[model samples]
Target chain A: MRTARKPLTAAGLLWGVVILTAVLACSILAGLSTGGGEGGLRELLFPAAGDGDGTRQILLQVRLPRVLLAALIGGALTVAGAVFQALLRNPLADPFVLGVSGGASIGSVLAVLAGIGGTGAGMAFGLDGRMLFAFLGALGALILIEKIATVDGSMSVYTLLLTGAIFNAFSGALIYFLQSIASLEQLHDIVFSLMGHVPSTGFGTVAVLAIGILAAVLYLFLQARDYNAMTLGEEGATQLGVDVERVKRRTFVLGSLLTGLAVSVAGLVGFIGLVVPHMLRLVLGPDHRMLIPCSFLGGASFLVLADLLARTVILPGELPVGVITALVGGPFFLYLLRTRRTGHEFR
Target chain B: MRPALILLAILSAACSNNLQEQKPDPVSPKDGLRLVVVSPSAAEMLAELGMLERIVGIGDFVSRPPGLNRLPRVGPYNAPNIEKVLDLRADILVTVRSEAARASNARLRDLGVEVLELDTSHWEGTRQALRTLGDRLDLGESAGEILASLDEAMTTIRQRAEGSPSPKVLFVVGRDPLYVAGPGSHIDAMIQTAGGTNIAADSDSPYQLVSLETMLQRLPEVIIDTSDNGPDALRGRLPGPWDTWDFLPAVRENRVFWIDPDLLVIPGIRLPAMTERMGRLIHPEIFGDPVEADFEPSPEPGPTETTIEDSP
Candidate 1:
């Protein structure tokens, strides 16, 4: 039993970190390799060769920023997913599992209908309407779900999850209603926003996104010990000097914030939140301290690679990043479920 | 050049070998040449040729001279009702070109209904459509006359634009998700003809979603909102969120204008008129004051002008 547990310990966590860093680096190189192949990824590494051509502009301006945004969003979502699973103690817990995606979708659809398809619906005080509205929608969903789920000043994880599920269903129906009334142009925007993509952003936007995601993720990381105690059950966590209720509220809000930012920038990319943390937990033990950062790196790598596949698989016309996530993650998730049930692994 | 010659060679050989499927109908002057046009601009084109009297069935989006509303709507531009068309005893049908949307054109053709699907979606297509419809309907001489008059108007508009201050313009096509008439679009051509540069002319598509950041950065001098919900609905929704971007010159100067899609959206032989109107909208000083032309642009009334409040 002791030998069997070796990989799920500190040593394994260290190796996992190293492995994830490598994967992220490789994924960035691999992503950069696909588009604007004037001199390839190596030339990009060498500034001299990568400059003075359209390929250079395409690589640095378009491809690099896209990959960076994908990585940031993916990492943020994975960290949030890890925290949520630890909080809810549900195997199926993901960012969207709590109505975050539904709220963002509503906001995005509203933007489409208002004639701000690819652009921000409006801008006020430097906050874009599309991003601001989506974040507000996410926060709104959180409040509504929490209000419905909480009873006697105590929150039930099951009720919280259920309320989220119902809200998401309600949002889906409402989106269908909106789509039914929309013009063909608006309808196209609605479909694409809901379908979700890792859209290209300016370097300035990418920098802001990366910094914001990093802040949120680092905040989540501060609560890793609490999340670790969380895996021992809420009572167990409380017994270990953790403020269980405060931790829950903070993590829920923080996780939803991460989800909102991700969705606003990249649309509804799925699976990274659900699958990345679980995979990390299996290899690095249920230690949130290690799992959180690993999840970020692994998730970043996973999304960068997935986004790479999305753009290249179809060539000029690309599949939505969400489609790629669902396609690649769906079967792997099923396999995890099937094997975990059969093999009794990583409880 | 070589490909054209080969195409010509193939066409001559094919035509000489009697491989043509299209046959003219046996409608005499007494029958008045029954026609069913499944597009608004096509209906407008026929109206330009003085053939509006022959149109028996119109499409859903064909809003004009208040009488066509009484004529049976075949369907949306693409999926027209063949049953109703046959019931109306229409000898020929004209529609737009979008591959899958109008795929039923093949079935309509197979059913012995002469389906003339034209690329009447852009300026070039509109020009060609005029000549083709004229030749097809034996009104080629009339088509020539209309083309000449339109050309004259275009030349005047071009000369008006020449050396004039061409302000940066943004043409909004849809609002909810911020789509614009980009490069290769009829709207783009109109903007170019009207002494304004389309800021979105660099986009790869004819119509595409543009980022608001790009718009603010581009800082358009004039913004034209062409998104038509309905006449009444649009009037209520006229001052859309465009004012929020007060940093934009268009918003700062209140140069933003809402032209009904009826006058602008439908690309056809009305290119000259549409281009001139766009000129007036974008470069009022260069093109002179804007004339509120006949809003009900139909040459002849169909029967009832039911405003198409389409949802489904």
Candidate 2:
């Protein structure tokens, strides 16, 4: 079993969390202060007596919810990535790679195809039809993947990986089929929904997402020690008295929940799950306890800043936030691979 | 001397036969030209030209001029079936210019099909396309009459709209992520012709995925929304979704319109009609309020053919 290169000191962990918290706060501030609207940091900082209500509405109602949604989605995907990496003991495992995102996408696309996309009959829990369908799709995918990968009550990581790969391919084909049958208007809606842009939502949506994401992250964090052990392989973790099966199942469910929430709200914002966790792991060692919390804060900061750039890059015209993240993450990920000789640090 | 005379007579007969063969076929009205029209705009134009009978096959998207509904569908404009086009024995395949359909168009052309790639996205393009279609189909007189009517209708609307206050109008094409009809689009042209200022005139492209906050800040006085096409989508003037932004002048004044995209979105021989509908939206006082039929999709089949909406 691989041990931590450096001892886990409380002070070091506390400082990492503190620094990330500060970074996240700064990112949120920057996101709030900047946008395509007339309001800016200067306008926000000094409210003139003649300032129109439009500027205030733009700042509060428009930018705030979007910023909060980005932060929540970013944090959730990043934490989910870190947990999946630990449980699967694979450096490349992410929500997208594990097929959870594909399932949620299928559900969302199906909802859109059913003409329930922006305006349909409201469902239970104040959730829109699309979001509800997406969450259900994620849950269904998680169960299906778990059932298929498990043989004789024991799940093999290799089998799980293969199942995920196959499922994702199937999902992609199915989405294309759905697109082919849709009308021109529906096609446009589907294409835009699939491309990762944070929807302009209300505070109610932000609050719901926050509660769900926080609850899931906390539950996953409690299993951090089991995740750390599982990284040493299933047999090794068993030898260490860890309930490997239980931990794996819990991680998969919780991680998928995080992915579903993010994707349901913000379409498919790629790279946050894959890039942020790996980045945090490289800097903070392969320890799950520190990595989980730090990943949440760091990922939130990264996405908030990415979203800020996405909205501001073209002035009046906005590029999808997914485009910005992938553009930045793809190159950074390649650089990490090239420079990190051995690649054992990830394991 | 008899042999020389016989040779000259044979040479003269041969020359006469050659001249007869080289003479062009006589051009006539409604000359037999088997056309396969894939573009809805082209189909609409052909119907107006009284040449719908010449169309052998229709495309998947051509729902208008219900007389063509009985014809075989050759597939969508971008991915037309080459076999179907050949089987129909089409003399000309009329379609809109699409980058995605380039390969299929090339294959069809190579297989001895005359492809007429028309542009109906703008007013000038529409006029040029109509003229070209007329000349090719030998229906120049019919096409000319349609053009005159279109120009006369447009001139009347423009003249009536003149000296009116140009209300700031927002033409929303999509809501989720907020796509808008910016400057240079057909909608933009209609808004200007209707004497309404386009809120998105400064945007870079004809169709742009715009910033919602920025768009809202512009404070449009009139909002024409054709974004929702779902079966359950609320129709007519209603603040279905725009209720969230009640501060918007459009929402506050109950000027948020939820009309069928077919009424104003599609550019074709319907430009003058579409522009008049737009005038109604921008200046309800002059052009009159948009009636219930304006918010509904064009009725299909049976040839009732409700092309223009009622004036309220």
Candidate 3:
């Protein structure tokens, strides 16, 4: 049976890109313009004194790197979510749904407690002990989760989600135990490491992160067609000459890489993975090709705006961007759940 | 013109007279003032002023001045029991200014109890708070006497500490995540006043999470651990963590001393005593050894339950 094509044609894709770019541009310009006290966002962005002034230096040197990091993390997370949902054939699957974030956090938190990465000051450029440990943790979790949930080379989605959820709980409790024994100074580092904020790093560090995320995301985008085929059920995709196992494995590893990078670089800003892709799916339809790129752009816009709110809403003190995303995403998730029918399965 | 000049002279004399009258009285009378004190340190300050009897309601943490534990408990320092506070007919409720007490402070005011928030987070603030609390209780002259002595003691310490090599000191508040009293902290000020440099003095925060490696590299000559597992509390035991880093000067020379949290941790009226004790720890040659009050006597205790500070 030939179904109808959705509205997301080339022209629609162009329009979406244009609008997202506009949103991003507007957000970047306005990020430092809110809150009217001393060191107001406006003064920081456009210092009345010359560009070499401290305010401008802070805006460019400190805030800009973090802002860019947030956008990159958001895009990476959403793209990973889209890939996971397609490969697992589960709409509920998000980048963090498989407990990858939990694993990454444990490694980083332990490193933070051990005085790795040079205190709370964020000194990692590439493959620092914290990031390396986090990568190892994420890789470890991926392998373990895959091993436990697979039977006869056929992975059960139900077991996969359940294993991921339980692993997350176990990791969380482990972090708490570690936290209890850490020094009071180490306690703050542990809590903040898990609390999830975009730490301000230099351009060299940002470029390294940008390249890693971009490479992983582009690799996933290349597998979009295989994802589209897998959406036609495992047996159906196999009959259509697609290697279902290979696709699943590749998606799993690539998605895990994206998630590991997100957590290790910026801590644990969750809900972007769940919220951004789900929203994009509704608006852009299930076609993997357009959805992948769109999720990246849309997610970038969403997080930049959310981070702007996180930084400005409290004035001087910042609410965690994770809190902002969850506040917005949790209710939206509930609305989606209530509106959708149960037990039908997406395929 | 003569009349105008005479009127202007009279006006100037009257203004001068008004200014003199407005000058604060050296001693204010405490006329049976009813009070409810929420902060333990604030209660200690009042007790120093001999106004502890006036505190009809006291916070849960106020376990000082040897007595006054018998007063009606008004709950924790942050959230005082509104019913108990009002029930005691307290004219004023004095508390430390804190984020934890924001809602409680407002709620007490709503219940018709007068509230005064005093900032006693630092040594400077402690003196001002005591004076303010004294003024609140109408006992300014008594607080003034205590302030004068505190000022004199600090001045003496500062003078003697001058021209001497001030060794860097690390004041550890906890372990695992390693909380330290950083720059702008009350403990940092005490370290400076006691003729030592805080190793974390340049850090932006008052109390901050720090790296153990950084602390080791800084090589503090003196280490003050305020963790509860001290020799007094732990049957003549040393904290297990400090021994791991033998390379540290503090650990090597055995300058790491454990002190009572109540005396040092809480910034209060007891700063003079705390300062003197810290001085002895940092510069024993100049200021002499610290006194340790034995809380528990061991059955066959070696060397009479004395603290390391008191050891000759």
Q: Best-fitting candidate, measured by lDDT?
A: 2
User: lDDT tens string, model 2, B1-312?
Assistant: 111111121222222221111111244434677889988778888877767777899887776776677889998777899999999998789887766677998898889788887777768778878888887777788789889988999999999999999999988877877878876667788999999999999887677778988888888889998777665666888878888787788988999999877777777688898898888888999999988777875455322242322100
What are the runs in model 2 whose C-alpha is more than 4 Å off?
Answer: A1-4, A41-53, A114-117, A120-126, A139-167, A183-188, A336-344, B1-32, B298-312
Per-residue lDDT tens digits for candidate 2, residues A149-232, read: 889977776688789889999999999998777665566667766879987787887888899899988888788788888777
Error of 2 at A35 (Å): 0.7
Candidate 1, residues A162-227, lDDT tens digits: the string is 898899999899988887677643554466566667776667677777777788889988998888
**Which of the CAPRI classes, incorrect, acceptable, medium or high, describes model 3?**
incorrect
DockQ of the candidate models in sequence: 0.06, 0.23, 0.03
Q: Would you list the clashing residue pairs of candidate 2?
A: none
Interface RMSD of each: 13.5, 21.1, 22.7
lDDT winner between candidates 2 and 3: 2
Top model number, TM-score: 2
lDDT of each: 0.69, 0.78, 0.67
Poorest stretch of ten by lDDT in candidate 2 chain A = A117-126
